[model samples]
Target: MSEMEVLVEVRGTLGRLTLNRPRALNSLTAEMVRVLDRTLSRWERDPEIACVLVDGAGERGLCAGGDIRAIYDAALVGDPAPKHFWRDEYRLNTRIKRCTKPFVALMDGIVMGGGVGVSAHGSVRVVTERTRIAMPEVGIGFVPDVGGTYLLSRAPGELGTHAALTAGQLDAGDAIRCGLADHFVLSDALGTLVEDLGSASADDVDTLVRRYAQEPPPSVLDTERGWIDECYGADDVAEIVRRLQAAGVESARKAAETISAKSPTAVKVTLRALRNARGLSSLEDCLEQEYRTSCALLSSPDLVEGIRAQVVDKDRDPQWKPALLDEVGPDIVEKFFAPGDDELGLSTVRECDD
Candidate 1:
């Protein structure tokens, strides 16, 4: 009914997309998701479209996240928009991953939550020194969706779990080292890089990107890999906390504190989802599992309470129902993953023989 929030254009052989809501830090709306998903699908089959390049309109970032205020409002009023939005968005994530074209994502700023959805599945993700990437759904009483479980589950060591628990931002180097991003380019050089890629033939896109990619500084994630793996790779949330507390390093202490303050259900479910994701065969399957868990959590009181405290009231204090990890039993965790009639209907998985 309204204009699309995303702008699609063609420059030479590149199918270009700019997120148009800079005033809102390019935070995604349901309309934005629909438009982006459809555009990528269309461009995938066009012979004239060599690749798709996506970036944000503003300087602040590519995308902050989905417009959670909408979900927060609907949750408060018992509306179903959040449910429908997540369903469509998850399917779109799958489409981006499976698309035939080379999809380049400019993740130069605050890439988190739903923003991660649109770009993490790209064929090539470019991060700059300013890249501040994370999957911070736990803060809002949700686990990572939009194929996040798949991405995090595959990250080097336990870096993914640490990010999930802490909602910490990763730099360009860290994003590359941790596998969130594939290349690092200097912030000032992005425009020229975009031009080169835009004008290159489809076959030359990779070469053009390599020509512009700069060597990233060393990654703290790589340096701290041992600590992250030792702490987050433990049995469960409680075990991870206990280990971090026992370690007594300032970093470990801070990590423990962050996990301690997050929603208990979100923490435990996130842990389970990450572990489950490690064993899944495909991104589509991980998304299916995430869809089930998301729908279940959306129906829970804690999500609404968390949104009310964080986004609506600005209280910074959510009275979570199962306030402790121990209180959230396996039954509660399993309930979120249980089969249901409203299961997200993703398209059939496309496979290629090796």
Candidate 2:
């Protein structure tokens, strides 16, 4: 029989979840998301389950992100599957954040996009030196979703802004610095940690993780924050790029070049979303906003082209419509945040009860 995409196991008081698609870097399929949500919900309600531990099978990474190829195909055929997948996925993220049981995420390797949504929201987020995290949606003509803006908006200074626009990877220390992860457990020790977790009570999970944890190596992102904060602080994407170019730092100038290559519309929308997320009181609100943005991008030419170039075509040369940042007018950006009929109604306010 084919292996399950997500492996669920109950070991004593610890419920274990593993993303099982190793070859695909454990990219989440819609079914996987549904399974994770359902499994987590079941575990949450189980009185005997004191803690839930999530990890990924195989050596490469926990999860790269959601199945982009699936998203690409859905976007091509105008399928409504992505919308439904995201709705459930975002709800799962919210559930992780609010989980009554000790929700522990072993963020051991490549965690990005939907992966971040799953792990970063957990109560006890553990990372290793092998960890590489990112929210790289802009590169594919997409805004960061799955409550990404909420987490990124809360990152210290504009490091989050830099990450959003540049689609850069964050190392273990950087992930911790950005508030995406909590503890640093060495890669070799993760097995022992898992064994420890299997026997450890819910109340002792935090202490057990700390016992295995060590101080992360210093984050280069933190040292570069002076320039990153200065460059990305501007509200406008174009202005941010201009600042990066003018900063006289090679890294800053490189960041400018990187941002220049991403979808102009996506970049602008990402900036606006991150800024808007800063004001939101809860992750649910940010998810609602992201749903609007994700839905809006369904019709975007850049979405298809970006995916084609980056994934399908592997050409790395996307012909983005409205190619330049200036060409992506405020109207184009505004539509991404506009109220939608099929809103993922997780937030309570709903601008005053319909």
Candidate 3:
């Protein structure tokens, strides 16, 4: 067997998958996504594999996200490769979402962007105190993908809208409260928990998770839910921005400022994606919608410019094409959600009984 960038092993009936690139904080590469998809498909049909455990290597835990550096490089040269990246990555994401066996994700450290895509939709999403979760794609001139629209839309009240626009980070408690995570456990206990799962059956794993899962501590954001609802309740991105600015609450004002720094076009598209996702019936539908938006976004000016300013140029100041939110008209935003070739569509994964 060839050594893999992504390591896979079977312990009893439990299949464990680890993202092995810790140096980059286990940032997901295209190759890794392909390997993961293949490994998962194999396990999906394997009678010996009764459950799955997905986690990150080293101390970081899980993954940070898809390799944006690769995407940025492709865009710089006008390569169409980024589309393939989103295509395969989104397919893998859907596979995880629709997996038949119970899937457990151990999110211990930085879980952001692509990380959220893989773990947040699992059957069991475990968050530890050290977990720092976010969807900070706007800062890089990209809208959130990987079923982010679904998760963000489903978040409590208007919190999803706020998080989408600002790329806000959510702590462990906020993750649980936002429904991004199902359980909270201490970071130190993850090793022992994994060991326990190796010897335990599916029922045993469920029992252990139920017994050991801890309630998340109170979150500062929980207290401000009412305010978030008020500011983000607007029907459109423009209205939401205006409401946040006019609210005059310290948190709302700060959120508006953070959002203002992101690519206006990206923010507008993200808002629309989340809104459209609200009507989606399944996670696959949401991922497909996001795939269309992402494929279209690759050709947009803001994505490249945003990547330049934030990642390549390292100037921390992107001269976003429209700069101002008002400059991104509805017509421009709508183009992102437009249909593309069938190649961008998500493929069906085999469903299993858990």
Backbone clashes in model 3: 1
List clash counts for every candidate, in order: 0, 0, 1
As for model 1, its CA RMSD to the true structure in angstroms is: 2.4
Residue lDDT tens for model 1, 1-354: 245468888988889998989888898888888888788877887998998999998889999888888987887777889888987788778888887888899998788888898898988898988999998888889888889999988998899999888888888888888787888888888898887777777778777888889898889878887778899888589999999999868899999999989989999999999999999998888988998998888878888887788888999999988889899999889898898998675635463111
Give the top-scoring candidate (lDDT): 2
Taking all chains together, each candidate's TM-score versus the true structure is 0.96, 0.97, 0.95
TM-score of 3: 0.95
Off by over 4 Å in 3: 1-4, 347-354
Error of 1 at 166 (Å): 1.4
lDDT of each: 0.86, 0.90, 0.83
The local distance difference test score of model 2 is 0.90
Q: Look at candidate 3 and tell me the lDDT of residue 85.
A: 76
Q: Stretches of candidate 1 above 4 Å error?
A: 1-4, 347-354
lDDT of candidate 2 at residue 171, scale 0 to 100:
94
| Candidate 3 lDDT, 1-354, residue by residue in tens | 134568899988889999888888888888888888888889888988878989999887578898887888898788988887787788778888878788889988999888988798888889999998899888877888888888989988888888788888888988888889989999888888887777776666677876778878777677899879998887677777778889879889898888888898888888888888899888888887888888887878888887787767789878888888889898998888777665444535444221
